[model samples]
Target chain A: MSGSRLSRRTFQRLAAGTALAAPFVRGAHAAGKISIGFWDHWVPGANKATTDLCNEWAAKEKVEVQIDYITSQGNKNRLTIAAEAQARAGHDIMAMPSWEPHDKAKLMEPLDDLMEPLIKANGAVNPTVEYLGKADGHWLVVPATAGSQIKGPCSRIDLLKEHAGVDIQALYPAGSPPKADAWTMDAYLKAAQACHKAGFPFGVGVGGTPDSVDTAGAIFSAFGAVLVDAKGNITVKSDTVRQALDYYKQLMAVLPPDVPAWDDASNNKWLISGKGAAIMNPPSAWAVAKRDAPKIAEQLWTHGAPIGPKGRFAPFVPYFWGVWNFGRNKSAAKSLLLHLSQASAAEKMVAASGGYDLPAFEKLTLFKTWVEEGPPKGTLYHYPNPYNHQVLSMAGAPAPPKIAVQIYTQAIMTKMAVRHFQGEAMEKTLAWAASELEGFMRT
Target chain B: MADIAVSRAGTVNGAGGRTSLHRLMQRKSTVAFLMALPLITVIVLLVVYPAIYSLHLATLNKSMERFVGFGNFTFLFGRETFWLVVKQSCIFAITAVVFKALIGFVVAHFVHNIPSKGQRKWRGMLLVPWVIPPAMSTLAWLWLFDPSYSAFNWILALFGIDPVPWTGDAYWARFSVILVNIWIGAPFFMIMYLAALKSVPEQLYEAAAIDGATWWQRIWYVTLPMMRNIIAITTLFSLIVTFANFDIVRVLTAGGPLDHTHVFATWAFRVGIEGGDIPLGASVSLFMVPILAVAAWFILRDITKRGNEA
Candidate 1:
């Protein structure tokens, strides 16, 4: 009987076989497959987090899952979405960036059923997320936990202290209440001028890229400038819009002379190269600085945006996970999305992204990676809008999704400022914007 | 006579008479059509269908559900950006093509003058810009034109010159986009001109030289006359490609600085793909056909006429 007992090597073999068979055993319950197209993460280790989450969900759901991390570089993701919609085929699940959900709302499966339970469990999503993710009465997408970046001021603490004599830490301390009420647009202009004169201007872009558009949107939102309202009416020829344009024109004067041609990476490069004292971007730039330029990293602080006439508003670009209505495995796709949206999984994703990912849910913002990991120990603490000092918004918000999407993607606000800066009469610029909006509305 | 009789008997027995199908199979035109069937199918499927579909799309409303009947075109005519785009596309294509031709011609002459042995090396090196992908090369240009940390600015500072706003100001952005296009495209022209220059008979040049023709006169009379077909054909081809160019403008300026640098293709992309108005975008792109067709007709007609004369 003792001799017949299993040997140690045999027991080890048995354990290995069981481990390999676990997924197949689960597959016996539901035999199916699903493919997902995810946006390639800019931060290192973020993709692995998503892959692991998806694999785990697949095993538990007994479905084979294939994930493709597609890059957003050069608008390839948008092209893929467009092509899939046109052909009525592609991955069952896809990651849609800000404005994309609204752009492809017709082709997306309504996610209201999946999102309602999530809202109850995790609290309501940010209003900006709702503005872009929901169209009519249906939730067009599930707000994703990856690549949701907030464009806030990542200023050089040392330079701002030296040149502008403003201690950003005192104004928006990492662990303390924000005393940043005095940080108004007027102060921002002054700081920009001072920085430029001191030979380190702010690296704010006005180009057609999303980075530039988002910043311009925040500034416009702060001024309560609604180029197009929710009813699809052209509101460009207004006093608030004029004020926003005038302010942007003046602000552009003090920034880099070539700000108008900058793409999304320009400001990142500008900051990493130590040429700009501040840039409105996500922590990705700071993360790069930490690796490539440690000295600059230590002096960097991510804080709230400056206040405007309306209020303080920061540019927020959120990611959404939407399933195509033409997808074959709609049930499996929704299940995977729900699995990834769990609070535990969201935290892991945020941590893996080095605090780059911001969960749409309020509860997941308390991930430890935001506080514990940094050169300044808490540099990204306020990155998630913890202090409530700034209203997070995206480009062309507060308008009808159809019209706002056009205004945002076409970069009407940035162009308005550029036209004004180049000596176009305010009235002419307003008329031009009004006519463009009118065209959009008609379309 | 006996062989003809035997062939006639074989043809009759083949289909119990000479059937129309058997007769057509032996025809030259039928054989040629059969040979061209694959190519014709590809052309229809890939090119003709897409173009017809695009035109059809242009007549639809935004949601692509209703027939609008030239509404998009009329709407575009009313917009200021559309006019700017049309003007900019023309200037961008014309200026870029003209410069590419001139630069290519000069460089080809220079290469021709070189010892034949070393010409290969120079040609190889000069063709490097054309060989590299436009998107990748544009990245290098973007870095060089960075406003804050531009290598050009560093070089300028070293000399006592202010940094040029390579892509910042509206005019400068136009110049920068045109410059990058020329840099990338001139090499293609150079290669074509080089091939054309090689084909020009050396005897004509020697005769012009013997007849007391100066360098400039010889080129004007001999080289120009000989390479006229190649030059016109290349120019037309380059014009079409340049007019429809999207990658360079999309990468460099993205039609920015108040839409001062937008060309038709980029604008169409912005309006169609990004703006979510596919019908409007299709209409904007359809505007390119008329201009390209005119250019192609004139140049190609000349080539056919000259070919018939030869």
Candidate 2:
């Protein structure tokens, strides 16, 4: 044997000793390590912007950071959140979809300290964010800019003007506050009817999907319809709800007959196929159209939702960055979140998302990305609610979250409308909704 | 040689009480069990443990903080949607399995009678549906049933027919989902019955022919009697799978049009995963076990009976 070679037993002993000491060695260096799971962005290069921002922060802070772009597709992000919360392990930070921060509030680290400073720097946070991201007066997560989106009327500008005689650009003009007083539910129904007669119907779905529920929620909110109040009382039997249902019945008649079966992608597909005058959606449809069919993309305009008896309401789904209480490097996680929430980083994220992402802070809403993105210039100018023309609301809000989540996920509002549209008696539909709301309250 | 003989004699004679376990381990049955240890360990860890954990989960309340002991079950029992799901799950499983078995039997007979040289190509083509992942194929089906751009509707429109609501109406949505399941599953039954067909003795058919039996009679008397076990087992398997189906319904309808098409699996997913009520989801899923267990019991008992008869 060579003099440099060790005996087999000695070699095995040394390997075993090293293996035994490895975790301790890792523990010694773990103080500066932070891992975060972000919602995988739909827009190309959006994830890279967030990654670059994180890398910049990590470099300045001398911390090692790992980032995971978790997709919300197939509920994988929610599944990851549930698994991490159950195991008390996984990433130090995770991007929580709307209602998820409330769902897992107990396991999340209260970020009042991180959020308060950001709130101070970037004006007041959106009330909808405060409603969903806070539990018992403590902020459980920082409102995220990566996946946050406002679902509004993304219309075919040419089709609306030519067929429906409603010019979207004139109503919500670029570089100015919306001249939207004439944009009411009655006008929306008239436009829908006109568009339907023109064979390019409005593609609004009343199915039990998130898009369907969100659209229904906004309409219901606009009519001041509350299925369950904040204090957990069932309110489905009110006149407001009945009025909302009646409006939906008229609206559904103008929609394609197959809308009841539509999934989340159905509306997007409907718009991109050039068969629909408008769809209630994020900029995803417009973005997809931009890539696949530029002609259709150039005509697309995202503007404010129509007004109702109470007010104009837009469906807002805000993603949040939550720190798990059991995370190893919480200090680093909080610092990284604060850094990302800053105006400069948030603006970069919104720009990268092609003006699709909406920051939760009021001050950050004026970023030029919304005004600048277009094939037809200023096509997305009204996307981020820069003029605050509409009330930003989530479906199933005002109810206690535990009940509201059921209301949202069960798609009660849409289902009730569908039941009524399918020729069920109005009273019968209201009773069914009342029963469902009761069940939600009971559970 | 003498020591070996002595050891063997001692094992057979139960000569040492301390070595009883050692002797037991040397037996053929014990050796077979040891050979199966890895698989048993795997099943115990993966299948049995998760099932038991899910059962435990079913008893807990929504938050899983308190043991509610059947509270989730009671809650599900009271909800109208839950009852609808139960009815829908049964209808989906039974109806899909029946059609799948019937179609598979007819197709298998055709394949069996075809020229042996061409059978391979036909079988491969038939098996394509089974081979492709259901998720990928279902996405294609989703496109084919797209509300605005359905290929099927386009074809119908060519013949002056109004576009059919393939997945919009509650009845049509149920039909669409069941049709997709049968399309994916019939191939599996075809291959199984094809194997069973090959094993049926040709002489038995000849014997029936000599007795002047018709083609239908031959099949009814000889072929069915022989393939009964395989049919029972395949139907049982398809029943279990169809009852617990999630992908087709989830991808197609997502239990929409007012929860008209929700099966147990999809409804459970909606309530449990999406709704963030894991305990209730577990309870919903646990309801599947009794129906599946009853099916398995009847099918297995018949198989066992036929085994004993043989």
Candidate 3:
């Protein structure tokens, strides 16, 4: 009892010793722990692949890894990022969507040293990835292997052939360069009209979501219609802009009247319900149909984006792996990110996603998963653009990040189309857009 | 002898009695303040602090670094969408609240007319919409409003009515959002009104009947006059909630059909959070304060007047 009831001096000495040894205690367990905020994958087994990869790396490095797969539904991922930024603490790494890496550059740890070796081994990253992941000569994020999808047209082969009289296989054959340069904006309009008349409309949205913005951006880019140019100039009143608007007006006439209210899920639902002949999206819709409606899934073919007047451009939404600057395990986070970016891991992710995942690296684009997936094998072979047939772009690109983010988030291009379709004068619509852009620039 | 006693007592007790009395008053005041400290702390921490912080946030630029007084507000004023959002918010809140009041009154009267034993069942059934979480119910509404496979359209098709765009056209989208708000909010109003109706003395209605007053007249004279306070309080509560509504509009239209159906909360979210302009978003949210304060002031004044009368 006397020994247990230590003197105050002895107690103080013991406390001092513990305090002195605390750093070493922490160092002993410095195998470290990391928490990652991952994007919730839509593909069936894609999340497992990511988890298994992380687990493999963790075992090898003797680090503890925590993964939280956050959903993009209702903009929850963005909300999580904002909440973490405001609180100055959260997951050590996060899977940032297309515009976020640039948006949160200051809060992120630079991954240049980790990415440089990966890039050298894997060839150059896609230019779109570089445009987003790098800002001010620093790599803000390492391009992620999962959930990086290219929102191109996924056409029902039977519906396209029977209604629109277009041969999907010939236009964009599997394991070959897409012969789709002749599939112009004019052809797209005619085909949409044909399909709509045949009671199968093209599923596209003009809502304030990524799916709508991406489609509208690709369409506008095809006509070389830059509302806000790269230099942050307002070009809404230009001739090309007028041409794009006019073309969109015609296309809108042939589309469903309810296109203005659709979200990212709407197009997927439209296609899976077998009411839409094609949708501008990645293969997730078809992947869902593969489970829910196998008959519809068998007929779906993922292919090249239709050519516009300017060129072919597909909307690519890439997820980037970013480490928080405030993270405790910076070394572990970077190392894990590098491990995930490897070609072996990328292939596993692509297979797990049923080719829904697109790797940003130039050499990793031709993963065998694309060649082997499906009821009709090789349906998604051309989804990944190994050749330079279509330019990989996004809604807010080519404009300065700040202004472009405004334009993209405001859903300006889609709104303009809706206004014109709803019987607004073209000149007035342009004026309204110009004024909105001016306001955004001012802010 | 009495004068001598009084003079002796006055000399003994004058300073000490006065000091004791003063200390007693001070002690009572201190006890009351200490008793209210928890509530004061809660208000200062939860409500007042956040309100002030949001005001501070509103004055900063997009990056939250530079102090740009009124810059965000000025930018919002210049925006055409901002004006549209203002108009839409006003229309949404006013239309939804009015309809909810009318519908709730009618439904409550219907429920009150039923037998007492059956009333509980009907009340429970009517309150199903209110009891369900808004997000879950909104998802059901979203599915029912789908352009292609809407259940409503399926029923309409059987009647040879062309599929009406429930959430597609701008006007219809506005109508849909308001309709959902009314549906979700009317039950609360109904229950409150029902309670007020029960509280009304049956003798008044009998007295009205004796005067040969019609059903409508009795409601207007006896029922309405008696329930005015409850009506005012419920309407004010619904107004505040409906104005700041986000889930219904966010899930249903997402300010779509060219942002035609956007309300204040959804637009603020789109601007501040999604658009990556926290300061501007904060400024947009702060716009709700004046309207809310005015409504609160009117309600509080009404309650105080009622209290004085009682």
**Candidate achieving the largest DockQ:** 1
Report the C-alpha lDDT of model 2 over A1-443, residue by residue, as the tens digit.
Answer: 58788989889999999999976664423548899999998887889999999989988777888989999899999999988988899999999999999889889999999988998999887778998999999999999998999989899998999999998999999889999999999999999999999999999988888899999999999999999999999888999999999999999999998888888888998999999999999998999999998999999999999999999999999999999999998999999999999999999998898888889888888788887888878888888888887899999989999999999999999989988998999999999998888878744
Top-down lDDT ranking: 2, 1, 3
Worst 10 residues of 1 chain B by lDDT: B1-10
Error of 2 at A77 (Å): 0.6
Query: What ranges in model 2 sit over 4 Å off?
Result: A1-31, B1-31
**Considering TM-score, which of the candidate structures 1 and 3 is the better prediction for this target?**
1
Best by TM-score: 2
lDDT of 3 by residue, A45-87 (tens): 6799999999999888778888999998778999999989888
Worst lDDT run of 10 residues, candidate 1 chain A, spans A22-31
- Give the DockQ (2 decimals) of all models: 0.66, 0.59, 0.57
Where does candidate 3 clash, by residue pair? none
DockQ-superior candidate, 1 or 2: 1
Per-residue accuracy of model 1 over A1-443 as CA lDDT, tens digit each: 99899999999999999999876664343758899999999887789999999888877777888889999887789889888988999999999988788777889999999999999998878889889898887899999989898999999999999998889989888776678988999998999999999999999998888899999999999999998777776778889998999999899999887788888888988898888899999999999999999999998999999999899999988999999999999988988899999999998998999998998877666678987878988899889887566788877878888888888889988988888998999999898888888888865
Give one digit per residue, the lDDT tens place, for model 3 in B1-310.
3212223344455568775554544464555777899999999999999889889999998888889998888888878888899899889999999999999999999999999999999999999999999989998999999866789999999999999898888888899999999999999999999999999999999999999999999999999989989999999999999999999999888888788898889999998888888888889888887988898899879877987998
Model 2 TM-score is 0.93
Off by over 4 Å in 1: A1-29, B1-13, B16-45, B206-211
* Model 1, C-alpha of B146: deviation from truth (Å): 2.6
> How many clashing pairs in candidate 2?
0
